[model samples]
Target: MSVPVAMLMAWFCEMLLLNSRSNQSVFRYSASFR
Candidate 1:
């Protein structure tokens, strides 16, 4: 509910989304090489 807490949560979620997107791209790249 606090401003800092909300900002932290948003940052965390963004990091998670970025990580998953990178992982997916890596997976696809590797699959293409197979």
Candidate 2:
């Protein structure tokens, strides 16, 4: 694969993992306010 593509794949994995945690935080905070 090209270098840029490889870099993007790595970044995507990081974004997915990071967003999963952030999503959970948002979900919990919203639930508490209800």
Candidate 3:
């Protein structure tokens, strides 16, 4: 793997991690209101 490719993969993984974390927080917040 090249340097740029490796950086891109790392960035993509970070984005996915951030998105999942946010979604989980949102789900929990909504659940608390019920």
* Clash pairs for candidate 3: none
* Tens digits of per-residue lDDT for model 1, 1-34: 6889877766765576577875665555444533
Clashes (candidate 1): 0
Q: How many backbone clashes does every candidate have?
A: 0, 0, 0
Each model's C-alpha lDDT? 0.62, 0.62, 0.63
TM-score for candidate 1:
0.59
- Reference-based TM-score, model 3: 0.59
Measured against the true structure, the TM-scores of the candidates, in listed sequence, are 0.59, 0.54, 0.59
Better of 2 and 3 by lDDT: 3
Per-residue accuracy of model 3 over 1-34 as CA lDDT, tens digit each: 6889877766765576577865666555544534
Give candidate 3 misplaced runs (Cα > 4 Å): 22-34
Please give the distance, in angstroms, between residue 31's alpha carbon in candidate 3 and its true position after superposition.
31
For model 3, where is the 10-residue window of minimal lDDT?
25-34
lDDT of 2 by residue, 1-34 (tens): 6889877766765576577865665555434533
lDDT value, candidate 2, whole model: 0.62
Ranking by TM-score: 1, 3, 2
Residue 22's C-alpha lDDT in candidate 2? 54
